[model samples]
Target: MSPSIEKNNNNNSSIARESITEQVTINEKLNLCFPLESLTQVRSDLINYSKINDKKLDQGLLSQLMIDDNLLCRYMKRRRGHIEPSVQFIIGALEWRHSLGLDKCSEETFPVELFSSGGLFILGHDNTGNTVLHIRVSHFYKIPELIGLVKQFVMFHMYKADEMGSRSFPLTGGWVLVFDCSNASLAQGDPEMLAFINSSLKNYFPAGQKYILIINLNWVLRAIKTLAFTWYPSAVKNRIKFISIKQVTDYIPLNELPDYLGGSVNCYRSIPKNCTTLETLRSNGSITLAQSAYDKIIKILTLVN
Candidate 1:
């Protein structure tokens, strides 16, 4: 289907559940509608081929990252003395995504986070049984300053590798990068970051490029806030998309996600439906999966135009 039709249909499909749409949940909706049969098959196949000790894909990747990436090895080793708690988890997640393509218990990145419902949900209960963390570390500092922090954090060890040993590290070549903003937003869209990001969106993100943007999600709020009423809106329309990482639990049927983008018509209908999604789905879990798929598939039954 054409992008416009897909967007329109996707937007109109979720009329019943717009009352509380969060980022990851919106992501789930998009994924659910995209191609589940294929995605599930790929997911299962990946797990079967991988999964050491029955560990999740992300976990396995972390292990591989330590052994295979030299720059990363030095980075980790350097931090041996530092031993920061936040870095431990962040490094673990980044390593996993860098090496293996897997989602988390709550929802991790392809290469970023874990699987699940609301990250900050009450006890964080995802249908898939993953606990997600909804954190937004902000540094209302300059973009260059933040970027420098990231580079220093990652490349610091990269530079130290020479003193540590060139042959003993796996990170001689840094890991590839892939950046997706589908689940991102900024507080105040900073023009500097926005411009750079949009430019990358246009000419940089080649078919298989892997990018790493090490920033707290909350930074997105700040980054986005700056761009909300900026001059780039028209120039960068649809070039990039961001989803908030907060709405994981508010899930219903994928078929019901599109209506969310309907602006007002669907918005009006969404209020009441969202209020009752829990009860509705709770009573009908038996059929929601199939029904959601069918509703979306039926839309393209003819595949005309």
Candidate 2:
């Protein structure tokens, strides 16, 4: 049977969700849509596997895994609906998170300069309601020594994005990563840090990346992309698009973007002075640091109007 690809009108990304009889495949937008039979069977297999391998599983991982259909589907899809390998992938991800203490990671885990640098933050939401993560590649060059810290910081955002996904209306639970490479040169690409980042995005964030927009293309950025593309897996590579800064308005509105990116909002002054720890934020259900900063900018804009 021919696949019936349906556009999800509610999303700004115009992601197409395809349904075919007995089988479905990844869409043009690289959306993770499979037939219900494969999804259901993989889910059941995981649950059954968990029962038999309880001793091998993390204490609460099974319960958490069972409840999140999206998470299960993501891993299953990543492994192409193979039950055993999918379970292994999920288990490996859980182990990596535990080893890294990702759940306990917080603002204090790294230097204050990391957050205040304005290199990485949550700017606003795109048209699809997915959170927009702005990463200033130029800023990263200034602190090459802090590569490990930088890795943790990026992962922390991924953790929060997942948290946000669980609570948000759309349930998309991932980030629209906007890597602003303006003024950044090829010299800024630290191989160690780049390798770490590449591994994390591929292994850790299961179906978590909504889109990766590389804006302000220059020769330097072009060189970096040439190298980086080789490092990305087919799944990760598919979601990336090289767009000019002006074209960013297609996925994200002009009003939500900062002036640097051809948006009206000036979020420079809106960076949060302090942030709640990841654990505290998780427990209290508070807004994210990035969201808080964007909110501050919006509030000021509203007041002036």
Candidate 3:
């Protein structure tokens, strides 16, 4: 063939080889070799769908969408590889996090009572390496008026759990939630908060919940919960298990659990006491206050085996 024709054929061959190599690399890395939709196609579809929907993500979110293969895989798997729904779900999560200033939330943003009460805290990890989120439901009623703060507080833990778990189990990182319902009453079940949590599990944090343990739930609450289970997807509903304190050890090693749950972990020590808001610490050039919060998190996370 002529010189120009040969050059064109060589360029085409190079392009074809690069394409096949990229596909193999993605499959090996993600371990997701979907027959119909590849990761590349899903990512391209996400960008195009975002534009079509008039959803303009900020640079950080855009980067996550494009570069975080694990994140994209989670959303894609959640939606069963449906490109449009996956894009919409992730965009919604990103926008919601940005709107709530989720990253900015810390122990200092709310009263010490919230953290001190031990209503919600990251205890340790499960037997399978998932982060454990402990919630003493009764304590939630103490600060009824602080529901807004509580919402942010809960999301902060979730975001932090995802961040922490991703480090250890990058592809399949998730959290195990334990709701201690011993002294909790129906009145403490704020409709708004419950709805927020339900929606969060279904939409915001896609495929990020490995298990949900409900300890000490009375029959009445169990019946009520059975009715509520109808609203959840089977994938989510199936992960929830009702168990007593003793059975908790089946999922989480006894040593990783807190004393209240018949384990050796002393979670109370990790609670940051009298720490100033991170914002205030940043403004005043006070590293000690910030370090306290950082240390608290480090201590809490390290407690998990």
Candidate 4:
């Protein structure tokens, strides 16, 4: 109860308060870097939810989930409340794929020859610097294969988005999908294909598809659009444009597209044999760079916890 003892107790109380204040300040900074609703925690909750539903998570899948979270967080940081619903929808699609025991489609397993020969290729960037994914819908017969090819292209766009640091807003500096349905037939409209396309546009493409220009839209495409619109959210539906073959130049310059699509460029070539494998894509420098950043963010989260 002496003056010295009382002073010592007061000093200890002051130090404790300072420590708590410092901790709160650190957390506020972290929340700026990483929102309070951490994507890592969301991923964990998803994994646990999957397990309860009799789905097992393997290391490879877990690694992918991490990458996905990283990609989502990168964009979500900028958009935050505006895009969280879309981000969550994407996570749900991933979870559904995992639950169905569907392995992530690899570049090797993808029908590269079919895509190359059939006229689906990256036709360089559009006028606005968005990567153009040129697809010849006529060449596709098998719906699942088409879905797989599209999925690979989606990943390709994500890779480019990461490289460009297109994190400020969803679909900013992303992909412009040009679907040339010149020879597309009504017979190609399988329910499963429609479902997959709907899912991709709604759940996956929202983050990367800056503009979806369906050119050479015949009756078949018009019919498909009717069906797809029923499932597409309003934001996604707004990005889609049913255009004439000649109208594509409004979005993509003639020099950027392939020769067949009114451009002088010869863009169709075999997928590099070495780069055809999923391993190669996974080891891409851009992806590695993004993953490094992701790892650091995760480390911070770990320390905070």
What overall lDDT goes with each candidate model?
Answer: 0.31, 0.64, 0.69, 0.57
The list of candidate 3 runs beyond 4 A from truth reads: 1-22, 29-59, 142-144, 272-305
Between candidates 2 and 4, the one scoring higher on TM-score is 2
Report the CA-based lDDT of candidate 2 relative to the real structure. Answer: 0.64
| Per-residue lDDT of candidate 2, residues 116-223 (tens digit) | 557777777888777787877776652333344457778887666655654553224556788887877765655666667678777766665688888887885576
Segments in model 2 whose C-alpha atoms lie over 4 Å from true places: 1-63, 142-145, 166-174, 233-235, 268-305
Candidate 1 has an lDDT of 0.31
Tell how far residue 37 is off in model 4, in angstroms. Answer: 5.9
Query: What digit string (tens of lDDT, one per residue) describes model 3 on residues 1-305?
Result: 99999999999999999988887786776666342256677677667756765444444655675877776676677777676677667777777876776645666665454566677888778888888888877666523333455688888887778767767766666787888887667855555676688878777885667888989887546655866777788867788898887788789998888787788877554556565543454366532335566565335323321
lDDT of 1 by residue, 13-125 (tens): 67535633554475465433223233334334434445442443345444543333333333333333232422353344444433322222111111011011111111121
The numbered model that scores best in TM-score is 3
Give the Cα RMSD of candidate 3: 8.8
Worst 10 residues of 1 by lDDT: 107-116
Number of clashes found in candidate 2: 0
TM-score of 2: 0.66
lDDT of 1 at 23: 44
